[model samples]
Target: MTNAHELGLPERVPAGDDLPAEVTVWEVGPRDGLQNESSVVPVEVKLEFIDRLADAGLTTIEATSFVHPKWVPQLADAEPLLAGLTRRAGVRYPVLVPNERGLDRALAAGVEHIAIFASATETFANRNLNRTLDEQFAMFEPVVSRAVAEGLDVRGYVSMCFGDPWEGVVDRAAVVAVGRRLLDLGCSQLSLGDTIGVATAGQVGALLDDFAAAGTPTSALAVHFHDTYGQALTNTLAALRHGVSTVDSSAGGLGGCPFAGSATGNLATEDLVWLLEGLGVRTGVDLDRLADTSVWLAGELGRPSPSRVVAALRG
Candidate 1:
């Protein structure tokens, strides 16, 4: 078999530093990816898409969200969809819950893990969640606390950590503060998002450095990057160099932030896997199978996948 670097892949960066041997990819295609679609995906299609992702060796998949149907009608089948899922022994399916009500619905659906989302920017917080920063925190406190108490693993998502569509150049310190608050709220991990896809590699390194300075362990952090400006892989490389192992990606590069109008899709899972495998980093994801799955999903969405790797491999 030909090695990845033999195909002209670049050498791993920051020359003497050791890259992580394995990275955990958190697949978000089902929830974040599909939520922004104009047409609602059928529940059966959503289920099969998730199954394909799992079969392709994704250990952690963000299946669906329990937010009110009014906000994301595309994911209104959260309950039934989750209920129909065939659980795998080592796989985790985490659902996004916006507030107490959402948490209630998720629990009733027998969700074992849940994620609460907040924003580093006030404008995004208001627009996305219809709550101010403080109110959003207040709203999530009990949800996180109660979920953790109930033996459900809780994850926190802090959106617009790098920049916001309405509020540009967010303060790194402010993003750190929100991240710390989420950690204090019993969240086991915090996923920092570049909601508007405005982050550069330098900014990503600096932000991770700041998080380290604030006593936030990189082990507890995951990076979610949008590919709008074509910097997602570059930014992911920077994060990996900084010891961040958990990455959020979508199959077929299928995602956009509905609230951030200018934003594009997420870093494609196949693309990320290609990069990681080329660098000799272990991701446990089958690239060819994942590409096939992306193609299948693109057919369902009635469009070609935005993933360059998927396109190239399928062609």
Candidate 2:
């Protein structure tokens, strides 16, 4: 394979106004990326994929979900996968815990970090969590509280923050209210998800401004964008301009909302790294290794990666 450097990296430009000095690339491939797969990836392969990600310098890697196997059979081997992991010193392996039962499994597996998925719209709450919008918080309250009490770092994911398939447009106030509630419930950070990828750059800036107006600092928030509408990179840039340092991405553009058919793959990590590297922002990610890792996983999944950076560099 040709070296990524041989193809030349993006030219570094002076850091723009309000852009963070450094960004945290939260890798969600092993969990979110593979959860949508039709075929189950073996536990051993999952382990290797995660190890490769850590080696590639991703400090925070979301390992797997503890959701019921009946719901996400693709990650049914979460326990074994977690057990087989060879953890790095400064790298974190967080898992998704749906509720109390999932929390129990994660605690038993010695997980130090966990993320909970929530919805901003009534329709999405009903469709995804089988609960009304208001009632969904009730379910998460106990989970967050318990996780916080256990001294585990908790991340709250608010999906459909931009747009929902069932619902046409989501209100900014509604998203802010949900995020504030999560923060109040002891979640350390809230990840705003464009679950269906319908948001534009303007929408991204407007939402982040609203969160700030509501007293939620950018440090307590993260952005997770999908590339369905080809706006993921643009939207991510807007978020960065608003001082959001932590960005969630999947390696190789591998994930979408499993509950929402309209949703597509996430903002690819390799793509994000390329952009940040060009902007002179440090993300501590090796773009070449990340692209290669994605390429390897694509082969395992029997498909080409949808990431543009991966394609461009690999070619």
Candidate 3:
């Protein structure tokens, strides 16, 4: 893994809850951002986009997802994509693994980090995971366990941490339960996802409070916000106030979950960078180059950038 100087923003962690001196951003542009495209982006395009993201100071990038092509036809080129990756010494490239099968493929590709996902609601869980909450946990118990034993950093995504379209008002109890279980099962970090972007700052406060009460340390959590209703930055500020240091954002705001009905734009990486930098929180990402990469992606995808900040910066 090569170090992306532009992405090395964790300088000095703020003491207490005052402010984080720096933040680490997980860039999901390549995997989550491109998955929903109606057109097939060439493997060359995907590789070039990743390199551009790296050049712009994105330290952590979700390179690709290893799922059945029948499910996500967009990522059918997973193997070739991984094989063609430009490995940087300090950059961390994590791949999304939907199941044990996906894990096998990731392992075959010599991947060192993998992300596994499950929703907080039954409806979303069944649709994305093809199983109930309990069943899904059973599936990951050993997968997470084995991944950890094998020295791979496993990330757990608990989607719909805020609300689900199929099941409204996700319960705080359910959120804490899944989060704790995944952490206990050997996930180094559990990313709390607002899949449909319906979360309010108050709701985010509620989740963090409950997670604290449940013995899940704040440091073990990461916020993954969607900008669907324009609450991403607000919600991120709320998370920061609560002492969370890591956030997941897509470059150019490129991804939406297919399982989430009415799911919309993700938090634009540029917007987050702007916010963090404005607050004087150290996020080593280059705001200028990131916007440039997003502009290129929006043109390549033949769509307007979901990020207003990207557009403003470009203009």
Candidate 4:
């Protein structure tokens, strides 16, 4: 039997860190993780993946994206995947809706929660969303409004919040501006994304300070980090210390941005769980189950998981 202690699960050692009592680990494996894969994952495998994640105690799992298939062909099974999903109590399944058309598809599929991706840099906004920096809000406004009207929760993702490949160092003001617009458009939460993973822990704290100065509470904020520079976990700790309770992570570190060449795998959920539990913060996730799930998914993908924690716990 695989023991929990043998799973490389961190011991609970409260260092008296100023962090949230309960943190929300928003699992983005099924959608964001699989979206960038060169080969399409079977929808059946995706469903089982979500079920396993839920059983591992992830409360919010991003299911799939409703974007055009021509772009993210890996998740073309979005509709069918949602159709076959057996919803569990106390678990929220949020899907990504690219536009009003995508929002329509999500609504038709009975999606209770939807997320919109926006960019903080002009170059990234143009490349990823086919809209200019400011123009992105125009596109999101109607989608967010309609979703809110339909009584659905909306999450806004602001990519390139810390740095951009083309634009170089991103201005904190620009990120706050984009995020404020998204929140003003009725998004219940705004997830700041280090799309290229160029952020440092200092940068994370500074940006959160900027949002706070701009009258945005940390309660309405989340952090999504990529591990390109190996700073994701430290940056996540910075966010948590800043009173941000929701952290977005991918199981087994399974995703990168297809649009952003510099973007790499997201902060791994297994790694995050170990860090949080070690700090004596509550995430309500089973480390042993999460590691086992990551191992299983890695086999399905025919590759080793990039997560250091997953690699260490693979015994």
The global C-alpha lDDT for each of the candidates, from Candidate 1 onward, is 0.91, 0.93, 0.87, 0.93
Per residue, candidate 1 scores C-alpha lDDT tens digits across 1-315 of: 885444434344433356788899999999999999999999999999999999999999999999889888999999899889998999999999998899889889899999999999889889988899888888999999889888999999999998887878999999999999999889999998998898999999999999999999999999999998999999999999999999999999999888789989999998898888768788989887898999999999899999998877785
- Measured over all alpha carbons after superposition, the RMSD of each candidate to the real structure, in angstroms, is 2.1, 1.8, 4.9, 1.7
TM-score of every model?
A: 0.96, 0.97, 0.94, 0.97
Which runs of model 3 end up more than 4 angstroms from their true locations? Answer: 1-17
**Residue 33 of model 1: what lDDT?**
99
Model 3 worst lDDT run, 10 consecutive residues: 3-12
- Count of backbone collisions in candidate 2: 0
Best of the two (1, 3) by lDDT: 1
Q: What would the per-residue lDDT of candidate 2 be over residues 14-89, giving only the tens digit for each residue? A: 5666799999999999999999999999998899999999989999999999999998999999899988999889
- In candidate 1, what residue range of length 10 has the lowest lDDT sum? 7-16
| lDDT, residue 77, model 3 | 97
Which candidate's lDDT is highest? 4
Candidates sorted on lDDT, descending: 4, 2, 1, 3
